[model samples]
Target: MQTHARRALATFAVAATTGVLAFAVPGAAQADAGPSTVRITEWMYKNEATAGEFVELTNVGAAPVDLTGWSYAASGGGPGQVPLSAFGEVGAGESVVITEAPAATFRSQWGLDADVKIVGGVTHNIGRADDVEVYDAAGTLVDQLAYNDQGTGTVKGPRTDGVSGEPKTAAALGANDASQWRLSVAGDDDHAWAATVGGASDVGSPGTSRFGDGRDPRASDGGDGGDPGSGAGIDPHWADVRINEVSSDNGDTPVGDAIELVNTGASDVSITGWLQIDSGAAASATPFAAKLPDGTATTTIPAHGYVYFSSTKGLGSGGDGVKLYLPDGPGGTAGTLVDQVSYTAGQAGTDEGTDFGAGAFARCPDGTGDFTSVAFKSFGASNATACESPVTDPGAGGGSTLNCQPEAPRAPAPCPPPRSLPRPGPAART
Candidate 1:
């Protein structure tokens, strides 16, 4: 449950303008985290015949990255701190694996594909409550991941072998949050699932990377962040962005259950790789955050611009909430939160016309005000002025705003209980 920044290259500093945490390095520049630029996406704890002790690296970034100058190291286990140099330039969305066991031995254990990249000479033994790291050419920390069997490490994982640590890789920063990982689902989270591939009985998909299609939420490119701008550090422009409005149930509505984002700043902000999470009883079962598609042309919101994300079933008529985050999730860590608003079932419904029968939750004065129930749906245009009745206490109606609150500190999502899965047999690589 704890992650240590092994190096002191950077320190935390709040952006005076936004009051958001920024890595205050002497010369921190624009750090762009793609998916998880060369991340230690998955690893297996050693158990005799159950699983192989190995570390998997993935280039979740937007572009290919060289691992030639990169290195892998393990701690809290057999190898003290022997940094092993890696080779190959991983293409975007590609995966390359390293292990101490024979490539064939590791493959047979996991039923991995022949084409899957594998390496031997992993002298380290993956263990319970162990730390594993991947560093860039400059030795900048790409990711230093730690996992424990009892859901006690930075990520809840493989208490037993064959069940590799399958952290969700969509959010970039979410990669590290225990809740965003698999294998710890049983008893840890409310749901459970498991898969056996390549004749391997492992409980996780070690080499597969799930993205946009609606799995995995962790993301990041490298040292700074992939929080779009927020993913790496605090964006001066983040303060001006707001969760303007939300519509629930009314899937029949043109926009279905939708969310609106507004930028109050003068200059446009790029939100590529940004993420949206719908947290509610219904959503909690399969909590998947939506990442903005890459490309400035489609991902940018002009100054004072308004953008709406529409869907069939994100909100629950009973009660649900929405949040916006920067894509800065580093391994075993969460992304920077931008805005969040939770609402009750009554406030989550279409207009019933009564005091509590309002149709949607909208900012009374538009983008910069508190959320009020309204009987209208403003897709991309301005909200209806007649819509009034701001919840005197946003929390009174089962609604709370993280970024909208006055002086509230920005929050990183706490690890959620993992979905359930029959743990893989305990045993690491040869």
Candidate 2:
């Protein structure tokens, strides 16, 4: 179904170049500045046979948006328009799902208590390319997305088989730019679509307002609406920090297998209670070290600062995995995984096959780029420059090691002398 309202690729390119899609309303003091009211945050036209397809809309505005006359249609206008008037209205920061699945199925799969408009019989184009358009009662185009298997606009390629299109961040520029979208990750809770419907993997956060992996824009705000020191509206989570370098194969000196972390966030992050887990072919992840062993308040990573942790356990010269967890309390728990990277033996990047390599996989663009091989390893230093020489023992030398002491050091008690004389004297007196 092709629509005449389809935007040209050239127009989107221009808009992206000029940053026009991110235009803020004059004097509008909001956290983000893209869509003012309702936006198509996520949508999935393809799914397992009985799973059903859905289009999720999010109310980004501060006030409720009436759905009295809002409608959605596919490009070429084949499936016709699905009127949302029956749902009444969507409150601020809320989401609504328009699906062909039964209400029970939709609720079970997404675990959403929000409005669900079930449109049966209408068949949306599930082909390589299609369009989703949303319009108000006044016939004004609110938002439209035209996706294709062949890279279109800012999107690099087609959506993976089971993956749904999700915004990279909450403040995504617009649906016009493919770069603003990413494949959804598995939700933290079991209520995820993947958990209910058996599939390749749970690829979208259907019910949650933000991305399921906690990559949502709101997560960056530190849970404070708009605090000054709260990362300046940026989430200081694991995604803000990158695993810049990893030395998996340190030969005999296992401690040399260090992992370098860099704070790519806008503000300093206190990693006082963070834990690093090394899962070596083990199904269960074990705590390998702590970011702040002493539990001191001074353990912080300044904005863009670098910190290296020498491995206490040997990392497989072959395939191995490492995870950074942010515990809710003093020590991390199973649910506190912040960031994870898994590499195959002799390969680079994570288990997903991204940025594959050997020796040390260092970030190409320092803190915020893809990981690649470094000619020379840099311990406790910037990854901007190529390694001049091999780093043999990252912790053994003068280089600073991440203090992994399980407890704080205490002064030894003075040895007690001649306790036997007191015991004999006490027995006699008794």
- Give the best candidate by TM-score: 2
Per-residue lDDT of 1-430 in model 2, one digit per residue for the tens?
A: 1121123233234442343333222232222233447777776644233345566777777788787876677643422267778657777776666665665665555444433334433344343244566666664556755554334355332342334667666556344555566544333221122322331122355544552222232223222111112222223444456566777755422236777778777787666545565542111334444242222224566687777666656555434556554443223332233444544333321222222323576666776454455555654567666544332221110101111111212101111111211111001000
- Candidate 2 residues lying further than 4 Å off, grouped into runs, are 1-37, 43-54, 59-65, 73-83, 91-94, 99-131, 135-142, 148-153, 157-175, 183-242, 247-258, 263-283, 290-333, 341-359, 363-376, 386-430
TM-score of each: 0.37, 0.49
TM-score of 1: 0.37
Worst 10 residues of 2 by lDDT: 421-430
Q: Model 1 over residues 160-272: C-alpha lDDT tens digits?
A: 34445555445533244443544312111111112222212233444445431122221222111111233344455765677777888557454568777777779877665
